[model samples]
Target: MFNNVYPREKYLKKIRPFYDSDIIKVITGIRRCGKSFILKAIMNELIDRGIPKTQIIYIPLDRRGYKNIKTSEELETKIESMLGDDENYYLFIDEVQNVFGFESVIHAYAEEGYSIFLTGSNSYLLSDEISTKLTGRYLNFETFTLDFSEYLEMKRFFKKKIDQDIYVEFEEYILNGGFPKTIEFDDIQARQTYTRGIISEIFEKDVKTRKRISNVPVYERVQSFLLNNYSAPFSLSNLLECLEKEGYKTKATTVRGYIEDLKKAKIIYECNRFDLKSKKSLRREQKYYLSDLAIYFAMNTDNRLSYGPSLENMVYLYLASQDYQISIGKIGKLECDFITRNTSGDYAYIQVTYTMQGEDIKATERIKEREYRPFRKIRDGYPRYIVSLDRFRDQQEGVHHINAIDLFLGKEKI
Candidate 1:
């Protein structure tokens, strides 16, 4: 499947640290976002490292043969039949959710000297079942769509030079998003058509089946409303009122439940506002970002990404990629796009804007001003940054100003 494809060497480099570790390699992400390709990439690496074909057992449970074979016992039997008496073997499974209680089988394999790697499209595959069964025995890697730099590498057209044309190409990427299939096909109309088709598939698989939603009509309307609203604070009453105006009768609890289930499923992610003073997480006011921009593009007929919200969503993706716990930061009325805490017990503030120009200039300045005051009140020295599309080599904010493109390239400033 990876034939002639530019190898995702960057992700491979990130996964290298976990190689040969006792933990199972768990690759997870949104559907059609290329989790399976990463698995194949790992297999290619093992082959290059001289691992014999006989020593590797690869199973894709999405197939019909494994659809009904849901128990751990059945998995063990299948493995035993495939590689009899092989003490040291590499086990690779894709879409393991088709097989119920498969995590126990994975744990059993890991116990017996078999190196296991698993990939799944839905978060439930690893939610509680695998987490409890393989606690302390898994390393997670999430695969998102191609970033701008990565998109350039994927296309041979921009091999030697990177300039203004590349920036123009990036704008198109922003509108269409970086889904591999969309990128593979350059036509805008075709890309939009493909996105719409995939949205229907996700509705069928993730929202309907995964969420077990009976009122498909209401669920679809709520999803469309959320997509259109992107990164705003949506109060429950406001949402319910809007639905009622649309002539859909539904309870607030049902709408809220569907929203949260979709979030846990990684279809949509909700960001709660972070209070610097009092230092507490607040749930009443929060923002939501979709797992993929393609979801918005498909559902919203306008197919336009609001500049500020889109930039915030981009920062959200960046923070998530770094394995940070993310939330929106609110100091009084001033807001920061993301507040993230690393594993080292330190936190940082991120402000994302499409362009810090015009009347928005003062508002952007106020965010940094508020950021400094709160820390002084608490006397905690966490870093602050403003990410924008502006070209400011040296901005006079106490907070570092970072370019959005550079942020995606992993050159975030403190």
Candidate 2:
């Protein structure tokens, strides 16, 4: 029923293979980052693959019809009434967490020999119970907002042709960011209004709904502190102290709970610091990145991206799309933008800078060389890359310097 498709079509290859594999294909992403569209796209693919319309059923739980059906029994009755007994069924459920006892319903469907696909905006919609309940029978595909390349293609809606210089688009993309729905806003006020709406919805659905955090003041304090410190290392104790200074009475456990709710909703993602030399996660402090940069803009008036933190946020979202397990890299005091574990059992060290030229040259080299130290200490030689807004692509020593445009366009690889 949805026609809006952005630049994520490239992931279709990775997505299609897992279809109808007796696994619950769970699509997880931030709200409005196009999880619903991905499900719709999959449904269209199933129809084209000769799966009959009569055999397929799609339910968006956010709709009025299904809003009241929270329990498994109600969901079963609804699905059973809609699904025919004669044919193998393909079920696509959006925002599946709204249904109570969803895991049991999913398990029962799998046992009944039906192929199921589900999408949830909240990260914890499928918990350890769901995983254990459907063990060895589920695969997950993460979705993110439009990348620069995807945003470029999306620009076609405004003009017949795109500008030849992608840097222009890159600048705009960095400023406006990759959320598809927000692009419809033509003015700053409208964009801000829409962005606030998204933030409020996420806070309500992802945090307030699932968490027992009754202290709204403490919750807001924690959220404000985290939002302001985007791309910075934060500890639970540090957060509690800051909240106290700000006149909000809070504790470390409460701050931790608030942060956990954000992670469960997939609103804010944590990348624990990894000691590359030890190849172990360090527990001292963790870095956080929001799923969408525009939301960061909406939350805070001060432009932190001028400090180039937004570039790090962009890299995290893009890497999340590539099926990479991301963590912050630590070598002594130096930190790498991203430490990704590839499928082939190798690791990648990536650094994102707004530009690697001029005054940034010395600092950029230090960042690159610092990344080498920990891997060198461990005798590991997985590829290390420097992604930047540099107009030219160059190779320094063994480190590859790529333009952000090429990185998003899939022209560059690690």
Candidate 3:
């Protein structure tokens, strides 16, 4: 049924390995990033594999029909009524966190030999309580907004193509971001409106309500500040200073709390600074990137100062989605945008720039030095890349310069 939909094959492949494993399959991501849609996609896959529809019990707790099923007892009763005489059953629960004592219900169902799959919009789903309850019995799959390749697929589905130059497509993706709903709108105004609504829903439901934040205006200012300064390094004190300059009086601890709340909601991601020379993580002055570029565009009206940071933020999300352990690299005054460690114990140092296409000889030399300096500092033989908007490729002194479009499209591998 969802064949026409953008198949998040990358995520699907991750879940496939544990299709019928005893562990509960948990999908967690920000709101409106298509967690619920993925649940449906998985259900369709099961049906295609010869599983009867009656054997799969799909419950979306966010729906009004299930609003009253708040506690574990109520959830257990509903599941009992849906089960058949067959010993094998599949349970797909969407936004299961909406129900109280959901962990108990999940444990009970797993004990009864049901293959359980769950989707949640908040990080609390993996909190200590849930972890303790389902230890060694569950596997978490993190989902995010559509990546550039997925966004391009959506464009192709609509028979839409940008200018022959790939940068045009990249520009659109940077400006509008990769939200699935936003990809459906052709009009810029409608896209922005939809994007803004998603942000509001995130703030209202995920941040405000879940955190019980009383000073909403302060919370909003903090959010705006983070979005505006996305991909830049700043300490908690620096954020507090900026807020005060904006005429908002708030304490340092409160601002820290609000930022933590945003991270928990998956609205923003924080990358700690890793000292490459010493091979240690720095405690202060971390960089923050939005979960989606659309959040930055939605919250800020002016895109003047965002282009470069937008590119960097996109790279951060791309690497993160690929399951890389990412951190900002610091080598004594010089900084690289990302230092990623993969599962194979390999490391990659990446520097993201808006463009490296045109400039005088002196300017081009400066750009190359600024981007390549940090990579040269590391003595490790791992890959070092400088990703930019330039269409050309260059390799100098073991550092690879790749086009950003190629990186996003998977035409080039890091």
Candidate 4:
């Protein structure tokens, strides 16, 4: 009965292999990142594959009719009423974490021969019970806000007006970000308002309510600090000092815990630093990038794009959504924008900039050397790239100069 549900092929490809498998499929991501739509998309796929619509039970507990179902017992009773006598049922639940004691009920249903799929907004959904009871019985599928390519594709799907200029389109992508519902809005003010509501919703439903922040004021302070300084590296001591300066006066553990809470909420993602000389990932001095660029823009009134970190943030999200394990690369004092390892164990080093053009040839040479120097320090044969917003491409030594728009649009691959 759902209409205008744009398909998410990226998640579907990962889910399709387990479509008929006995193991429970668990999907997790940030709120408003289209996890529910993926559930509906899977349902549509099942019907297309000749699975009877009646045999597929989709329960979105957050909806009006189901929101009143709170406890596990209530959920079990509701699910029982929906189930038929068939053993080949495909069951899907969205935001399943809302129901207390939901683990046992899902485990029980999984054991009873239902091909189950589930989604939750935060990491807590996988903790405690599911980690123990459903251990080794389910596979987790990580979902993300749309990549740049999908952003344009989705706009086309809804027949929204799109900028013909690639740079303009890219600028809009980073500014408005890739939330599926945000596309339905017409103006920047509307989009920003929508994203701001998302932030409040995340803190209200996912953080304060579920995670239980005893000191709301302190937590909000930390959140604001992190959001305003997004993409910059900060030490816990530094953060603690900053909090104290603001008269928030919290303990290290409290600040640390709040940071973890933000990460779990998917408002901020932690990126650890990797030491090339030591061949290890450092535990401290990590940078946190926003899950979507809109998070930063929505929270702050300063709409001017800080090109350096902004471009870096876009590259980070792009690589991450493509399933790359990313780390900030350090070689002595020189730093690479990102050091990434794909699922297949392939490594790639990337440097990002807003543009390569400069006032003079000498200035341009200096910029090029700074971007390429880190790649030279690494003796690995893996791909190295200097990605920028330049309209043209450059091939210097073994390093590739690529346009950022092309990279996000899937026209180029590192």
Candidate 5:
């Protein structure tokens, strides 16, 4: 059904390191984030390397053909029947969590020396049961929707170019998001419809059915609240109060459960507040960003309301996908949008704003005091940045002010 192939080299680079290893490769992400396509790409790579098709066992439990394999035993029996004696095999299972007792089957296959690769749509795929069964035997690769570079690749695939000005494309990207399937549609309505359908499938299969939540309307209200207030700090009590104001009488614990369910399904990401001065994690008033900005656009139907938060969410997702450990920064009364720690123990303090170019001195000073001063308060030597839409350069006092588009396009390094 796809017209062009979008080379997801970032994920492929991650998978290449462990190719043919005994450890199980587990790929987890939100629904329709191209997990199945990644598997197909990997299988094609294996075939190109002279691996026989007969030796590679691929099963997609979500498909109708595999609907009969409801139990772990049935899955194992079918897989085992395809294997031959005394030979290496590659097993690719998509949405493997559909079968109960799947961990046992994975363990059995691992014991037989088969190189196993699997994908699932929820975090529950790596819950305690699976972890305990496959302890020290698996590696997880968390996938996300397309990054800006990948989105650009998709645009190029359709023979569209934005060489002179990219703000036009970036604006559309900020609205439609980077879901692989949604990138093909030139029509705004079609893109929104596609993303709405993805949210519905996630709600139905991943949240409602998986969590056994019968009150879907209540659950949806909680989702709407989160999407509307994306990048804002709110607690369980705050969510409870909002729901109460909406005439939905739900307890704080129920709201917390719903939030957790959305997080597990990868529909939204939660960022905790970290006290920069005290070097501790704050418990209350956490921020949540949606898995894709298109979700908020699909639900709200107005991009203007979510414009600023959408930019912040985009920065958060980009940093996260690059393997940064991110948290909201709070230094006493002041707040910084993101505090990211890289793998090498390097830290970066980032503040994202829509624009910092207005001719109003009061507005610019407000941004500096609120967003820039917090970075100055830190005594530690680390890179600090203020990412916004302004093209002007304001690199002073050890703080770098960069355009958000340049950051997303890899023209500027963090």
Candidate 6:
């Protein structure tokens, strides 16, 4: 139905309500996160809904035909020549940020009631400038590299051999990550190599070309630090101290600026800490999660799985993709892995661990208590959970312990 395009229903379900509406759909993500592929899937949806192929326009600015259209005027002329006075036209443009001053052109079409869709590799498409120009005209839906479920499904789509034991595949999913394109490669070496290529492509086209870094070496160190230590909490001062300890002299401001550049380029996402006592968000000691675990695997030589942080990172991406506003919850000495709020003001607290089963009798109970302690301290009656790889799905102290495999495979929900 998607013309060889694997359907990302998580995305399509959100956009389906506005399929034929006048609202402009904006899809943004890291490089090669299948932004363009989702655009094609949307076009196929339009066709299945009885929209003619002629009335649907697919223009990828980075591709050969439109590569020369670098200015807004050129883009406007091309789009104008393609439109006609027939039924409503469904316009899809990938890599829309390639053309300078392209917002006005997109806004122009949206204003004319054309059903417009756009995808960009970096955050430039949703910058303050673009926001000001297209205010109240577009609804953005961010995409991620694949989540665990999609990773397994995509392998099936390509006819890759499947293992009956999902735990075997789980290891691969965590190490290989969820980049849709990277799944095309069968071996870990090829997949990791392709992922590294994506990292380089993003830096060249989005990061380096858009932002200037005077000290490339220092920035590289900072990048390596963040990539190597995903899901760890650190402050600028802490980072500065670490750099000084390593014999690298750089100011906190320089480190801060480089981190901002990486975040803006969609390579990393920062998660703030929430003080459960004060009911406020804290700026310091925040954790940063990589766009995909494959990013960490591609950049580092550590193949050993660190389930604590890796599972937490996977849950973070899943919650974010499901449109949950997430933050670290701090209650005095105790901490909850994530405090999430849905669009309807519903709240859910989560704790992620490798297992609830301990090495011994005391250790098993200690593991369970360690994970559920923070949830017990919470004053509110919001839904609390402990997500782990434990085979036992039981409840302790009113906290539900769910298997990570079940949580990701849609057999359960947090």
Error of 5 at 223 (Å): 0.8
In the range 1-414, model 5's lDDT, one tens digit per residue, is: 222456588899988978888799999999999999898888888888998888889899989889778798999898988887649999999999889889888988799888999999999887745687889999999999988778888777777655557877788787878899876687888999999999999988888777787567788898888988888887787777777787887677777889889999999999999998789999789999989898988887566745578889989999988889999998888888899998887999998888765469987777667666788788788889999888787777888898988888789988
- How many residue pairs of model 5 clash at the backbone? 0
- Candidate 1 regions with alpha-carbon error over 4 angstroms: 63-74, 157-164, 359-379, 411-414
Off by over 4 Å in 6: 85-87
How accurate locally is residue 22 in candidate 1, as Cα lDDT from 0 to 100? 53
Expressed as tens digits, the lDDT of each residue in 269-338 for candidate 1 is 7888878766899987688887777667766668655777877776787677667899877776666667
Q: Total clashing residue pairs per candidate?
A: 0, 1, 0, 0, 0, 1
User: Cα RMSD to native, each candidate?
Assistant: 3.2, 2.8, 1.8, 1.3, 2.0, 1.3
Instruction: Report every candidate's CA lDDT.
Output: 0.73, 0.76, 0.83, 0.88, 0.85, 0.88
Per-model TM-score on C-alpha atoms: 0.88, 0.90, 0.95, 0.97, 0.95, 0.97
**Mind sharing the TM-score for model 2?**
0.90
Please write out the lDDT profile of model 4 over residues 1-414, one tens digit for every residue. 468899989889988999998799999999999999998888888888888877988889989899998999999998889878776888898999989989889888888788999999988787655788788999988888998889988999999988888778888888999889999988998999999999999988888886678788899988998888777886888878887888887798888899999988889889999999999999888898888989889988899989888888888988887889999999999898899999999999999988887899999998888888888899879999999988887788888889888888788887
Off by over 4 Å in 3: 1-4, 158-163
Off by over 4 Å in 2: 1-7, 157-164, 303-307, 359-379
- Give Cα distance to truth, residue 52, candidate 3, Å: 1.2
- For candidate 5, the TM-score is 0.95
Better of 1 and 6 by TM-score: 6
Q: lDDT tens digits, residues 308-357, model 3?
A: 88888888898999999999888988998888998787888898987764
